[model samples]
Target: METFSSIECFVRSAEVGSFAEAARRLSLTPAAVGKSVAKLEARLGVRLFQRSTRSLTLTEAGQLFLREVGSSFNTIQNAVANLASAGGQPAGTLKVSMGTAFGRLFVVPLLGEFLRRYPAINPDWHFDNRQVDLIGQGFDAAIGGGFELPQGVVARKLTVAHRVLVASEGYLQNHAAITEPQDLAHHQGILIRSPQTGRVRSWQLTNRNREHSPLMLKARMTMSDSEADCAAAAQGLGIGLVSMPIAIPFLESGGLQRVLPDWYVDDGNISIYYAEHKLLPGKTRAFVDFIIEQFAEQGLAQRFSAV
Candidate 1:
């Protein structure tokens, strides 16, 4: 097995393009870095670098090897940092990006408690509908939905949210009916335009027998905000699809009523994602644990009936 010390020495040398620079960074002698690289090359049976009197360059094998092993190095670093930080008080900035509605409704309300628990943690939050590139944006983490996460990021599923098709009683009273998904094709559907992609949000629904299908409805009105969609639905404009939590308050107030109770859809899980790094900092770890604990306390899994 290749020693971690040797691998780290090689990585630093490759990054700095010189053994002398790498040794300086790692507080080792240039000869020590060179010896580590030689040992690594011998073990792998491949030349990683080609050295000239003036400069050093990676061999073709080295380029490929570094590409494959960079992430592994980062993971190792993060694991070490996480272990070291255990039981230590969190201190530093925790940068997070999240969707506007979720941030406003859920995350914002819980911020006070998190801050009170870890006063040493300073939070920098960005609320938007746009999907952020966490690494490029220098964010520690993000709250997101959907299945396609970017490469080199670790995604942890936090909670599943149910999407319910709802319409005001007044709207249903005037419309033909919405007993089935196909029936929505003829009715005036309030389309939700995603602020991130500028496309009308589509719905996935399952029937009483658990047969699921994606439905694209005809839209008479389109809005970017869920609150606006709910308002329009309440005014008898059309059927609006929204998360269960958002609809619950309105349902109890008699502003909206659930349609086709036997049918439902999943918006997928809310995930906390971060760049796959060698070491997770103290503040980031604290926030991640806090988020998980809060969700657990709220019975987040049970709320969506997620198994």
Candidate 2:
């Protein structure tokens, strides 16, 4: 009974290599976490950690105990999570909404591994550009930028939505030299038409000195979404302004080169929006944690910074 808490505390401490870190994750004071681990050591009749002022290390016995408890605890948790799962098993359908291009490029691919981890949970995902009413529409979560958050709605930011001007290398070779943000108006531009507002979107580009310049480039084509914007630039239709993530692949392959590489538009942040409630359903919570973990591990947030 009480032993489980001590075991969990010990296991967490070992995994993170610090008692303070384990305490923060468990929502307890560091002293409390240390006491719990001390109790576990007393019961097992062995010193588990070799402690120094600046570092913590596991003893041979501690290593053996951790290997044994960590695996068994996970098995126990998954099993108990079935009947008494408190945001654990995530058995029911997890419904989510996200932008078509972003979902297809990022979130959709993570589904395979997420499903593998929680076999009991089913995913129901919607890929669209329009923002969804999470509560009214019965969606567990939605991912995108610029969604108006009504009362009782919350968001967790995934990444900064920094946008850059890009064009195919071929287009750049033939076009007049583009040296700065204001120079964009002289070239063929691909713009995004807002479906909600029905206006060709405009952006204020900024530099390292925090100075802004408004540029309404002449549009040769107006696309509905970022994928099309990137594709248009890749095809040499025009210089397209879009988020770095959407343009990363083309830029990496040398098909598209950044125009005025030092400048970018601050388009706010991409986030996961969910309805806030006292009790979050297991499925929604699982999906949220999974996505956040994936992002952190892969350094997805840092990938799109100006290069």
Candidate 3:
């Protein structure tokens, strides 16, 4: 019988088209992944992959085998995970992905309490600005805004991903007062370039009275991260469009002040995303529920909202 490790190595290598890339995702050395696949191929008595110096292509038989076992492995893992958590506390590596600044500011603060409550689970968190393949990349969960819901993944919303304009007191004092959205045209902008798109994002602000206005500002500087935008605005570089979660601390510290306070850009909701499995792992469920409960307790949803 082919071992689970060997099967996993073969499937991952097939999906990624290379042993080296599969090894990185599986947290194994390239040689180990290659050896595992070789073992599986030997047992099956067939060439699973047409391995070459530069590439690894799946053979016709390998493609058929992958189609049969690829999804089966995930199902088997989920079943095993469910069983493990059913008889005991949530135990294992809980892998998650989230936006760097938001995770540090909000989610990271909850780690101590979460760990105290569930010590058996070890967290493996990846923090970056872009969305991740929750299932394909083998993440237990992800937290962020504006993710396209892939098949078998669901999002539990946490808070409104609202962006509000902000500027330093010094900068505000020196520049023309911004009492309305149209006034932004006169000020310089510390803009955010979308990490996914690599294009400077444009905002359409909505006021309390269901009024909409386009954001027009002279581009003084551009950054790919919202945290950097806040920092630049705090330094009196220019007015910035900042997410409420990232701006909350700076606003409280008086480093940044809301410009046109009534107007905000609704990007969407920040959510905890997980696989839509019937037998969901306890760690994923626990983390998702805990985050929702904490956000509610802290009134984060209201605090992060502009309207």
Question: lDDT (CA) for every model shown?
Answer: 0.79, 0.84, 0.89
Candidate with better lDDT, 2 vs 3: 3
Ranking by TM-score: 3, 2, 1
* Two-way lDDT contest, 1 vs 2, winner: 2
Looking at model 3, the pairs that clash are none
The numbered model that scores best in TM-score is 3
lDDT of 1 by residue, 164-255 (tens): 77799988888787667778788777877887678986678876577987775688888887667888889888888776655666777999
lDDT by residue for model 3 (57-141), tens: 9999999999999778877877787568524888788999999999999899999999988888899999999999887788999
lDDT ranking, high to low: 3, 2, 1
**TM-score-better candidate, 1 vs 3:** 3
Task: Specify the highest-lDDT model's number.
Answer: 3
| Global Cα lDDT for candidate 2 | 0.84
TM-score of 1: 0.70
